[model samples]
Target: MPKSIKQINEKIKKGRAVIVRADEVPELSEKYGTKKTAEKIDIITCATFGAMCSSGAILNFGHTEPPIKIQKLWLNDVEAYAGLAAVDAYLGATEESLDRGIEYGGAHVIEDLISGKKINIKAQAHGTDCYPRKLLESSFTLKDLNQATLYNPRNAYQRYNAATNSSPNTLYTYMGTLLPQLGNINYSGTGELSPLNNDPSYRTLGLGSRIFLGGAQGYI
Candidate 1:
């Protein structure tokens, strides 16, 4: 079951930490007959990863080794997972919805509820698409590795799958209260990554663990 913002806030205030299990599993089944026999059942396995979030840190625990090719632009699965978790902790810690800026607490609660592993994975992928621009623009030199701006550079990017490129999904841009006033958030044109695809650069970052936490700022 999903947790409420109030509940999550209390936990955070009390220094509550959670491990999010993103592993996709097969649906279980049960059988009943005239004999009324119950037996163990086996099912299929699916792809999924684990995520952990705390007031101070976030961790992405997975069976497979994360791909971290470029030291400058790439964000490992653990960093991606932690970054998103930190964002969520920031949101939950703020508790802005209690103010008059919000009319419906449910909306704020729902928004908080949806910010999880699924969104984290997507956001990580978006970060992957934006890595090149981030590296080129940041102060960190590719040669001298001192300041690690690669942790969370405040940027965003998106692209559609090749099969659906002709039609294309809704053009996405990064918009958040925490996000600085940079124009790098767009699908294309006027400060955007043009021609999106499942590029190898994304792989260089990692297997694309994307995360997203969406909503108008100041509301919640």
Candidate 2:
């Protein structure tokens, strides 16, 4: 039976769906044939992702007593963009911290926050008539924030670019240090568990596609 995603979703809701892992597709296809395998499976979980698919967090610090509009924000010594709202800021994973250097960044801050560790908070704002506050220095944990949302705009690509160094001397890059003369070829994404690879034709994927993002249920 040719089952559309809508049909599969209906089956899933009614407890009639059969799900399998992406890696299991080959064996099942060999055992039952491609057509039968396709008919039997309602969902194939493509369990994959990589650190290269770096993401960020949107944090709502909530309002302070007679809050001032924040112009600059820092979390755990990492500068977070606070141009959005009064207390809302975004902590990017790749953002480097002044104190920790490149070794520690927004990702570490997020990890620390999730681990229930205290993070230093600092902000500067111009005082207003109703909100008369200028400098705000504080500390917070993950629970302290009104909302912390994991917002990932980047994902591992199916056909990612390969980086290589052809120069006589070593070259340094964001991917890592590359030796000269093609000493290393860094493939950004290997396609394993990539949604595009799992659904090559994008058959079942569309607007509002459900996914597990950072271990949380989310949608595209």
Candidate 3:
């Protein structure tokens, strides 16, 4: 008999559902026939050893005693956009600092903050009567911030295209190092655990779906 949605959910809640890997379907099918395997399996898990995903974070520094519009901002040497508000800014994972290349980026700063390490927060502003502060520099940890959350506008892409260079010289692109004369092809995303790949027609996964984001439970 086919299991109902409620029954399947109950089995999952009780940890009694049989979990299977996508790659093991063939072996399991041979062992217990396709029908029997389908009846027994409740969940399928996909695996991708390495997958490149774009992500970023937003940080709110809360209100300062004397509010000043930030004209320039830098977090851990990485330039962050501060045009949203006086105390709001966003940091991207792949953003490179003007002083320090990719050696220290927003992703590294976020990791350090998560690990309870202090990071430098510097800002410059034009002095005003209400807010006379022209420059400010301080060190702050994640706990010190009013709010910090990952806000990746585009996380897992539905699909991606591969790239190759036909130029005579090598090219250093975001896609990765491209060899000269179409020597090698570059591709990103492994398809495993991708929301779109699993739900091609977008039936089960939809708005407000729970997702694992940056080691935390979030919703899409």
Top lDDT model? 2
Off by over 4 Å in 3: 1-4, 19-37, 45-54, 156-158, 166-169
The alpha-carbon deviation from the true structure for residue 220 of candidate 2, after best TM-score superposition, in angstroms, is: 1.9
Clash pairs for candidate 3? none
How large is the C-alpha RMSD of every model relative to the true structure?
22.2, 2.9, 3.3
Q: How displaced is residue 146 in candidate 1, in Å?
A: 3.7
Over 4 Å off in model 1, which ranges? 13-18, 24-145, 151-155, 164-220
Count of residue pairs whose backbone atoms collide, per candidate: 14, 0, 0
Q: Which lDDT value does model 2 have at 134?
A: 89
Candidate 1 residue lDDT tens string, 1-220 = 3445476567667765342221211112223441222122111111211111121112232211232122221121112223332112112211223234335332233233334212211122232432421121212121222211112221223232121122223333222222233422322221122212323264323434443223211110
How many clashing pairs does model 3 include?
Answer: 0
**lDDT of candidate 3 over 1-220, digit per residue (tens):** 7777688789989989888767677799999999999898987765333334466778888756677677788988888888787778888777787787977777788778788999998988886887677787888998888988886555546357588999999999868999999999988655555556666787656778776666677777
True-vs-predicted CA distance for residue 61, candidate 3, Å: 1.0
Segments of candidate 2 deviating more than 4 angstroms: 26-40, 156-158
Query: Candidates' TM-scores?
Result: 0.18, 0.81, 0.79
lDDT of 2 by residue, 79-129 (tens): 999989888898999899988898999998988988889999999998888
What global local distance difference test value does model 1 have? Answer: 0.25
| Cα-based lDDT for every prediction | 0.25, 0.82, 0.77
